[model samples]
Target: MVRDLDHALKHVSLRAPAPRFERPRPPRGVFTSQQGFMRALGVGAVLLVAVLPFMDASRYTMSIATSALIYVMLCMGLNVVVGYAGLLDLGYIAFFAVGAYISGIFTTVLGWPMWAALIATIVACVTAGIIIGAPTLRLRSDYLAIVTLGFGEIIRITANNLKITGGPSGIHGIPTWSFGPWSFDDGFNLFGIDFPERVVFYYFVAAVVIVVGVIGAGRLAKGRLGRAWKAVRDDEDAAEAMGINTYIAKISAYIIGAVWAGMAGQLMATHLSAISPNSFQFLYSALILMAVVLGGMGSTPGVIIGALFVSLAPELLRDFAEWRYLIFGVLLVVVMLFRPSGLWPATAVLPWLRRTRPTPPAFTEATAVPASVMESVDGTPTTDAHEGDRA
Candidate 1:
């Protein structure tokens, strides 16, 4: 009996331990992952926009669509500052003004080509960004907002007074984009289909807004600088402690946003062939900011949706005439009351659309160790090997 017990003990000790239990991973399915779903959504949106002009082909329709696209570009740029960097910039339109004025002066006054004006616009916007951001970024919250608001007013007033900017009348006769002898005024032929000037311009704006405003900003948000921006936004002191230069991060975001707005301004200048002081008013800034907040800050899709809604809602509600503004305000209030975080916040998840995870197996007799194995030769309960090793 003693020999048999010894042999049993030896066999048990030498045997490999039962395989550790691991919760089974959820099965992968189409659109199961957030990244896959977002990618699909973005592609679908692009396809929809690309087909819209084909469906209507009307000047009125194209104009509205183009305007909406411009709004998207502007909002995306602002999204970088307000959404990603957590900065409340009330003067973002200043950059837009800078781009418009520069492009106008270059193309109209200096008699430079549209391409050259574009290059100058970019440089001016970058310089303006540094000037505004370097000094003001150190301030936080309400103070920063106030300072930015003042800056916006100052830019508008200065534009209104400047002779080159055409004072209150603003710059007029701003020419369309041209490359060498080819201009947007001359439409193109693609795949045997003749595209009109308006249609071509619409396509051009769509490409720029989607590529630079949407994709570029989205890529930036996923990069190292973007991470630093987020860290600073969450806690400036904590980010600094972690070796991040909070000032550099904040200013970089400001500068990138300025460049984006400047590009949008140039596009707008070409689209309208004119720009006015009234166009860059505080009200417009408020509307843009409202779009960002309504769409959910830090969310790219949400910002785009918000911009479209703000830009197109009035037209859609035109049947109400003068009461449209009141109705718009009421609707905005209702949305805020219901969804304070914006229509589609960054953390939002659709429960119905989400893939369900299988429940982990419950503990049972089969999973429990045998009483004999739990005890030592002297009959005292054996402590866990892992616990002993940890001790």
Candidate 2:
């Protein structure tokens, strides 16, 4: 039986595509390596953020930009769960709320510094991550999603009912980060230009935070942990057979994602100076998930772009009036139809531009046993007689 099984497996080619049909790959525009593409993208994002303030922009414009940055962070965090680990979490916003409320309580109730609130939020989020992931990570697909959705709603409802969270009105007067007398709350003059202190400083802070988040997420996605996540995501049984602890990998992904979301929530709380149950509805969860899908899952650049689109499309299309959402729906449908793998998928890789045939081996190997050679009964060549003839 063992011999038969090994023989049967040996004949099965490992290189075949899945039984399910996959969409045709889109053409690679110009990128040859992942590193080059990401570097270009990072530089462009930094340049764009740097120049936005100088562009005669209004307060509304700055607000939109700030919101977009927050969305980018959220989407990237979710990417770890959905994109890398292949987990379908419907209520990821629960962690966001967890972070926000924890940080809010820390700052307002305990009168701690913003940095302390940030650290406490991360710790709480990690604890929450373990609690939520322990049992649900054992489930798969829709079963997992249902539990997450329930968890999300539970968090929201609990916040609404709790007095410490300020009931439905939520918590306010959450303080922003400050260093002694110099605070983000205080505006100032720079390079002969008087800027609105809160707007400029806050925007700068958000941008820096987001930039760091993007880099950190990208780095994690490229490391050993990421490989384990991908292995489990592709096939849990196979991953286990290969000695990978699928459960641990899944839980680690959840925890890391939780940490990212928690930090973002801290920023969100600080950015808005308030927290309400209304702010963490299922609608926001759905939107963030949509952004992950619409942007190529597991692709950092794609996720960022997707986040920006989801966050800004409503405001950008407000001029279209009642037809705005309809138009937006149509556009999303078009993108799905045309680029189902996403506008830029993570799996895109450049083929070798130059192909070369393998070099030939040196003398000892015989080609076709050579027409002139004579063999003895045991298949040893008659070279002994040939040696005397040559001498």
The candidate 1 region of ten consecutive residues with least summed lDDT is 362-371
What stretches of model 1 exceed 4 Å from their correct place?
1-29, 353-355, 358-391
Per-residue alpha-carbon lDDT of model 1 for 186-300, expressed as tens digits? 9999999889889999999999999999999989999999999889889989999999999999999999999999999999999999999999988989999999999999999
Indicate which candidate wins on lDDT: 1
Q: Write the per-residue lDDT of candidate 2 for residues 1-391, one digit (tens) a residue.
A: 5565455456543343233333444434336445566677678878888788788457787777787887888899999999999999999999999999999999999998888787899899999999999999999999999999999999999999999999999999988887777777676778998677556654665665556668788788889999999888899899999999999999999998898888888888988899999999999999999899998999988898889888999889999999999998898899989989987788754355234333443333222322123332234444544354558
Query: Which 10 consecutive positions of candidate 2 have the poorest summed lDDT?
Result: 365-374
Whole-model lDDT per candidate = 0.88, 0.83
Global CA lDDT of candidate 1, please? 0.88
TM-score of each: 0.85, 0.80
Record all residue pairs in model 2 with backbone atoms less than 3 Å apart, i.e. clashing. 187-197
